[model samples]
Every structure is written in structure tokens, then in C-alpha cells.
Target: MHTTLLKDFSVSAAIAGFVTVLVGFTSSAVIVFQAAQAFDASPAEIGSWMGALGLGMGLTCIVLSLRYRVPVVTAWSTPGAAMLITTATGVPMEEAIGAFLISAVLITLCGFSGWFERAINRIPMSIAAGMLAGVLLRFGLDVFISMQTQFVMTFSMFCIYLIMRRFSPRYAVVTALILGILIAGSQGLLQIDTVRLQLAEPVLTTPRFSLSALIGVALPLFVVTMASQNVPGVAVIRASGYTVPISPLIGWTGATTLVLAPFGAFALNLAAITAAICMGREAHEDPARRYVAAIAAGVFYLIIGLFGGTVGSIFAAFPQELVLAIAGLALLGTIGNGLLTALIQEKEREPALITFLVTASGITLFSIGSAFWGLVAGGLAIAISQVKR
Candidate 1:
């Protein structure tokens, strides 16, 4: 592993890691903040939550990636946080913390029992690919949508991407990142004042368990994180053709969450969208070397954790168009590859297409996102087709 990192440390991989963190933080950090507020957490507690989550994610990513020698990226439960935003309101902060602990325990059990791993392993690769493609389809489209706001910046990045792709394939993303920053700065879109660097202090809260909190918040969070985040996360690994053990990965997340829940680590699970960024060929042409990107991401996440107080401002300082453009450009190849894989099998083509379309629709049913729904639709399609035969 040491040898691999020393020889395969590419600028593209590092940039990929940076881009993944930027997109993850800018896109969903607000939801996290809102969730914290719903629990009536003080500002200090919120900062602690950020620190705990950041440390959990960072440490997990580094340990798991190094252990497996695969890019086993872990993330805080984005969808789970969204769930809490609605369900956690009116609940006491103590109960909410209790709910978090309960959810963590449940997640850990799922991992230790190996039930979740078995279920994920059974998913058809075509459907898995379609689900991943569906999840990422929006980001891919955002690349072009960014043009309406930052035409010069978007077009310039796109052109540089094209030029670099033809000339220096490995550094295409790195070059685009540089060009995007330069263009954003030139246009005065960058806000320097919003960014204030400081250290974050963790605040611990004691959890008081309740049946109502368990049923209302804990169960829902656990279900959403598992169904929405971890499921697609497993698909990303398989879609990328890496065979890391899913059970232990899920188990470790649960364990980390259990230990850190007092500090606001609500739920930790395998990553879906952001993990794809690290797992893709753009991160490293040689799959074996891609773990470095995940490690790099872990380091950046640690920085975010230490400076949790400024995370919101720092990410906010970057123009929305830049974030959208960079994330879209970064995942372009992964989206295309997923779609192609989903559609390649003749018999599975229709089901895969249905999965992709449903997922891309962005519809929400029962507070669950379209990715899980897409899989359900694809499964029904396959089942009906098989029944006809």
C-alpha cells in the first residue's frame, strides 16, 4: 500500500478527492444544519456534531481503505439527516440523541449479522449500475445547466476538459478545477470574507432513550440510511469492479456511529454518490491506486472537522455554479459508464432503462429517494418479464 501510494500519487486523484468533498459539503451541509436545529441543538452542539461526523467519516475512510486496499469511502447519512429534519422536530434533544444511538446499533447489527451484505450482493449488476446512473444523472445534467448562470466559467471548464482529455487524459479534471477557480475569481464570484478559519470544539450530550423516539426517529433514520445510502454505495463498489467485504464495512460504520453519537454523529454508512467520485477511473487509471484519493478525501474531511465552525462559510464562499459545474464534470465519466453497463445486457435492457428513468425522475415516495424506488421498479419489471416466460 505504501509502495502504491508513493508511485501512483497523481494530481488527478487528489483533485478528485477535493472535488468530492466540495460537492458533498456544499450540496448537503445545510440539510445537516437544519437537522441539528430541529433537535434544538445549541450552536456549540451543532459544531460538535460536525466535528464528530467529520472525524467518523475521515477515520473510517482511512482505516477501511487501507485495510481493504480498496476505495472504501464512508459518509454521514445525508438522507438520514433529511429524515430527521422532518421527524425530529418536537422531539427533545436527549431523545433525539437516543434515537441516533438506536439507529447506530441497528446499523451495526445489520452489518454484524451479514444480512445487509447478503441482500446487497444479490442485486443484479445491471440494476445496480442503473441505480447508480440514475443517482448521478442530475449531477451530469447540472454541468450544462450551470451554463445559464456562469456561461463563461462553465464553457471554459468544458473546453479545457475537452482539450485536456485529448492531450493529457489523466490531468483533465485537475486542469478543469484550476480553470474553474481562475474564471470564478476573475468574474468576482468568489467571496473571500465568508471564509474564516478556526478550530471546532466538540460538545457532548447524554442520550435519553424512549420508545417514541426509537419508533419515530431511530427506525426511520436507520431504514433510510440503509435503503438509500448504503445500498447504492455497495452498487458503486461492484459497479467499479472492486470486491471489498460489504459486511465489515457496514459494521464499522455502525460501530463508529455508536461511539461518536454523543458528539452528534447521527449515522455513518457507506457512501453512494461521493464514493463513486473516488472509485472512478478519473481518480486513478490504475484501480489499485485509487485508495489514495479516498485517503486524501479523509484528510480533507479531517480539516473540515477541525474547522467545523467555518465549514458552512467556506463552502458557501464558492459560487454555486462552480460547485455544480465541477461536480458535474467530475462525475461525467462515471455516469456514462453506469448507463452503458446498465443497458448492455439484451434481456436486462428494459428493466435497466426503467430503473434509470425512475431514478432520474427524482420522485420521493414515503420519504425515500428515487434511487431505492428505481430498484423496486426495475425488480418488478424483471419479475413480470420472468413470469411471462
Candidate 2:
């Protein structure tokens, strides 16, 4: 078993895993931090939040990927965290924890009951592909957008990425990342001085359920996580052509989040964006070997959990443009694939285009994200077309 595992692992897979963690943490971690602060959590409590979330994501990503032999990644719900920042204001920390627990319970129920998967399955693949494309469109655009401010670094990474894609496709993202880091370091853009090594200790908060929190915080968190995060997450997995069982994936993440919520794991769900980093061909030439990338990501998540503060500071030290450039470059393949799949079916093309446009527009309504709205709009378009037919 050990020898087989060793054989399956590759340098490209490991680098993909590292990039997954880097993009996941650097992108929305600060919003999570702000959400913690909204509940008036202390610094130690915030670290505990990071620790619990890291542990939950790590466990799910590793165990699920190994079990299914697919790149099954999990992440904290960024939309849920954003909702918390607004709704958790003035809510006691204890009550907020209780709300987190409630949200987890709801997610777990949805998973075990298989309702969420059933609903997701009804949505046609083209529509799902459109939603996935919309969600990823920003990252693809950001590769060039980063050039506006950091032309030397971003453009160099982009050129290296294209060159690598033409010659050594498997190593393109990793090569681009290395070049970006080297250039950023040379430009004195890396803030290496501020990172301090510190072990994160979990600080437990006992649950104190309140009606207001349950109604205000828990329900909204649950809704946003399901609609905005998990929906697109499942879409990514399917669009990538992986048939891993979605119910168990959702169930395990909910179970993990439930276990860690008291320690500040607000919400855990399937990962869409970072999962693409691991699922794409860039992770490995053979799709069967791509599970190694998810396993590698799990190891990195454990490191982040154990040394939450240190890892957070390390991610923070990198220049924003470098992160943006690398992420955009890494995801280029997945985004292009999504767009192609979305428009391939003539019957679904128009609706899929609507979904893509609405999603890329980044419009939010009733606190839900563009992903959910895009799905709704596409679904409606399909319904209308059927009626006309």
C-alpha cells in the first residue's frame, strides 16, 4: 500500500496541492477573520477558528479523496463567512457557535437525506458547466488584470505559463508559480519579515443557542453555504467528469464541521475553485493519479491547522498580484473547459450562456451569490424553452 501510494505521487500533483491551499487561504481567509471579529472574538478565538476550519477541511479532503480515489476537496464557506460578518454583529460568540452547529446539522441532514444531491442532479450538465464557467471567469480575467499594476511580475508569469503549457503541460502551473515567486522576491515584493512561527491552540466556546441567532444567523448561513458554495462545488466535480458520490462527500464535510464548530469552524462544504486546481490536467497527466493532489492538499491543511497563525502570516507575506497571477494561470484550463462544455449542446446553449453571463456579472440578491442566481436564471430559461417547444 505504501509503495503504491509512493508510485502514485508526482511533483506536479504536490505542487498543485500546495497551490490549492495557497489560493484557498489567501482568497477568502480575511473575510473569515472579519466574521470572527464581528462576533467580538478575541485573537486567540480567531486562531481557533482558523485551526478548526483547517482541520475540518484537511480531514475531509484526505479521507474522501483516498476513499473515492478522486480529487475531492473541501473548504470553509466563504459566502457563509461573509454573511456572518453582517448578521453576527452584536450576536454573542456563544450564540454564534450555536448557530454554526445548527447550520452544520442542516447541511448534514441535506446530505444524508440525499435531497441536495437529487436537486443538483436535476440540473442539466450544460447549465452546471455554465455556472462553473461563470464562477471561474473572474480568475481567468485576473491573470491579465494583475498585469495592469504589476506588469513585470504578472506578465512574466503569464508568458512562462503559456510557454510551459506548450512544452511541458503538466508542469505549467507549478513553473508559473515558481517564476512568479522568484520575480516577486527580486522586486522586494515578498514580505518575509512579518511571518512568525506560532502553533494555533483551539479555544472552545460552549454552545448557547438563541432564537435570534438561529433565525438570523444559522438559517442564512445554511442557505448561503448550500446555494453559493456547495452547489457550484458539485458542479465543478461533475463538470470535471468525476463521478465521486456527492452525498457522502457532503455528509462527511457536514459531520466534520459539526465536530469542529464549537472551536470556530463556522461552515465546511465542497470546494469549487481550489478543487479545480487539483482536478485539472495540470495536477497530473492521469486523472486516476490526481487524488494525490487532494491528499497533498490535506497535508497542507493539517499544517495550517496546527500552525494557523504562522501559515496565515506566510500566505499574507506574498504579494497580492503574485497570488492572483498564479491562481489565474493555474485555473486557465479548467475555465476554458467549462466554457466549452457549457456551449457544446445546441439545445442548452442559450440557457447556458445566460447562466454564464449572470454568474460572471457577480450579481447578488437576497444575500445569495451570483452562482445560485445564475442557476435559477438558466433553469428558468430552460423551462421557458421547453414550454415554447
* Candidate achieving the largest lDDT: 2
- Each prediction's TM-score versus the true structure: 0.98, 0.98
Q: Write the per-residue lDDT of candidate 2 for residues 1-389, one digit (tens) a residue.
A: 56867999999999999999999999999999999999999999999999999999999999899899999999999989999988976899999999999999999999988999898989999999999999999999998999999999999988988899999999998898899889989999999999999999999999999999999999999999999999999999999999977888888888899999999999999999999999999999898999999999999999999997689899999999999888888888899999999999999999999999999999999999999999999999999999953
**Weakest 10 consecutive residues, lDDT, candidate 1?**
1-10
lDDT of each: 0.89, 0.93
Task: Evaluate model 1: give its lDDT.
Answer: 0.89
Deviation in angstroms for 29 in model 1?
0.3
> Which tens-of-lDDT digit does each residue in 1-389 have in candidate 1?
68866787788888888888888888888989999999888988999989998999899988998899898888888889999998986799889989999999999999989999988776899999999999999998998999998899999999999898888877888888889889889889889877888778988888999999999999999999998898888988998888988899999999999999989999999988999999887798888989888988888888888989697798898899889988888888899899999999999999999999999999988888898999999999988988854
Going through the candidates in the order shown, the clash numbers are 0, 0
Listed per candidate, the RMSD to the true structure in angstroms reads: 1.0, 0.9
Off by over 4 Å in 2: none
